[model samples]
Target: MQLSRFTDYTLRVLFYVAMNNDRLSTLNEIADFYGISVEHLRKVVHALAKSGYLKTFRGKHGGIRLNRTPEDINVGAVVLQAEGAEPLIDCSGLDCTLSGVCNLQRALADAQRAFMQELNRHSLADMLDNTAMKQRLIGKAV
Candidate 1:
């Protein structure tokens, strides 16, 4: 199942913040790095803070940081919350005669379960463990 843009942005914010855990990261900086709208990131950051995943500070030197450690933040938990409760495939919207008997939906559901299970095996830190990826994503030598 493909993740929504909102979820993608949520993960991006988490990744960038976790990488820069030594200091606070501003929304404008993250937006500039990812080439995404700062307005959109404002919403994302607000939600993340509300969800207890991030802590935000306001004022002249205000920015954001992870409220919890990188290892404490589960990748699957983040995705599940960001993705919401919507089903991967909305077969109810279509007018198919085999809707009741189709195994495709079940198969897809199982696949999604497996996908999340794999993601559950890793944490935010796991994704940033690669030296090259860390350097590239943080855009600095580490």
Candidate 2:
């Protein structure tokens, strides 16, 4: 199963923010650091802010920061919010036209739940320790 670009970028943004810790990261800073489009990240940032993951400030020194601790930001919850719904293939509540009852929907739901349950076991804090992500983006973090 593939996730959307929006969800992908949102997770990237969260990782960068979690790494910065005390600093209030700017949209441009993250966009530049990740070499992503500022315009696209602006939308993602706004959505994250609205959803209570990050808080934004307006001023010369203004920027964004996580509203809660990284350990508190459950990956599963964030994925649900970013995806805007569960990634399940719902056939229908109605009886199937097929003679045999297909368990496709039920199977998909179970798989999706398992995926989320794994995510729920961790937080943004857990992901930030990823060495490859840090090295790819920050180059040894001077």
Candidate 3:
């Protein structure tokens, strides 16, 4: 299943913040690096903070940071939070005549579950294990 832009940005924000766990990271800095909108990241950050994945600070020296360690943050859990528990196919809203007879919904649901299971096998720390990627994302700072 394809993830929404919101989920994509959510992962981006987490990666940026986790890489810079030594200090707080500003929304503008992350947006500039990813060429994303600060306004959009603001919503993403707010949601992350509310969900306890990120901690935010205010005032002159304000920014964001991961509330928990990278190893403690499960990729599947993060994706689940950003994407929600919605089924892969929203058959409820569709008036499909084969709704009861079709096994497509079940198949899609199983696939979605398997996808999440695979993601659950890796943590944010596992993703960050690539030094080259870290260097590319945050230069030599990481």
Candidate 4:
């Protein structure tokens, strides 16, 4: 299953912030680094701050920093928060007669649960543990 762009952006924002934990990062900087739109990043940043993943500062020298340590940020939890409680598939709209008899929904749900469980085993800090990879991606000498 493919994730929504919103969820994708949320994860990217988290990764970038986690990698630059040494200092506050600006939206423009991250936007330029990833070649993504600053406007879109603004929305993602706002949601992240509201969810307590980030602390946002206003005014001239304003920027954002992670509110919690990278080790405290769970990938699964973030995915859950970003995706909300929406079902992966809406079987109600289907015209198929096997909707009630089919076990596809159950199988999909189980797979989704397993996917989240695997992600839960890793944290943002674990993502940055690969120094060479982190440096290569974010251009930071972490």
Candidate 5:
């Protein structure tokens, strides 16, 4: 299953912040680095800050930073928070006759559970461990 652009951007923002944990990061810098729109990143950053994943500072020298340590941020938890608990497939609206008896929904549910369980095993720290990769992407000395 494909994740929404919102989820993707949320993860990207977290990764960038974790990589540049040495200092606060600005929306323009992050947006330019990833070649994404500042408007979209602004919304993602606002949501992240509201969710306590990030802390924002206002004014001329304002910027954003992670509120919690990288190790404390669970990848699975982030995905769940961004995507919510919505079903992969909404069978309620489907008019198929096998909706009641089909095992497809159950199988998909199980797979999704497994997917999240796997992600739960990793954290932002794990992602940040690839220092070279992070450096290349964010151009940070860290």
Candidate 6:
């Protein structure tokens, strides 16, 4: 199934925060660092903050930081929340015409559940478990 840009950006933003660790990373800084659009990243940051994934502050020293440790942020939870919709296939619906006529709905639901269960097996920290790889992503030691 195709995931939305929101989920993609959520993962990227989480990785950026994980790379910075304790450093209070800002939207502008991350946008520049990744050469991405600051405006787009800001939306992702806002959603993350609203979901309790990140903490935000105001003023000259204001920035974002992880509300939980990288280990605590489950990849599946992040994706589920970031995507903001059930991973149901086109056949899924409360009153789906094919609900009882076809098996696709149940099959797709099972697959989606399996997908999330697999994702739950890993965390943001698991994405870059190696110190060298983590450093490479951040371009420095945290």
Which window of ten consecutive residues has the lowest lDDT sum in model 1?
133-142
lDDT of 4 by residue, 70-132 (tens): 999998899889888666766988898897899988888888888989989999888778878
User: Which prediction has more favorable lDDT, 1 or 3?
Assistant: 3
Estimate, for each residue in 31-51, the C-alpha lDDT of model 3 and write its tens digit.
Answer: 888989999999999999999
RMSD of 6: 2.8
lDDT of 6 by residue, 55-94 (tens): 9988998888899999999999999887755647665447
Question: Clashing residue pairs, candidate 2?
Answer: none
| Deviation (Å) of 36 in candidate 3 | 0.3
RMSD of each: 2.1, 2.6, 1.7, 2.0, 1.7, 2.8
What does candidate 6 score on TM?
Answer: 0.84
Clash tally, candidates in order: 0, 0, 0, 0, 0, 0
Model 4 clash pairs?
none
Model 5: lDDT to the true structure: 0.89
The CA root-mean-square deviation of candidate 1, after full C-alpha superposition on the true structure, stands at 2.1
Which one wins by lDDT: 2 or 4? 4
Model 2 residue 132 CA deviation (Å) reads: 4.7
Which scores better on TM-score, 4 or 5? 5
Candidate 5 local lDDT, 87-127, one digit each (tens): 78879887999978999888999999999999999999997
Q: Evaluate model 1: give its TM-score.
A: 0.90
Looking at candidate 3, the ten consecutive residues that score lowest on lDDT are 133-142
Q: Whole-model Cα lDDT per candidate?
A: 0.88, 0.83, 0.91, 0.86, 0.89, 0.83
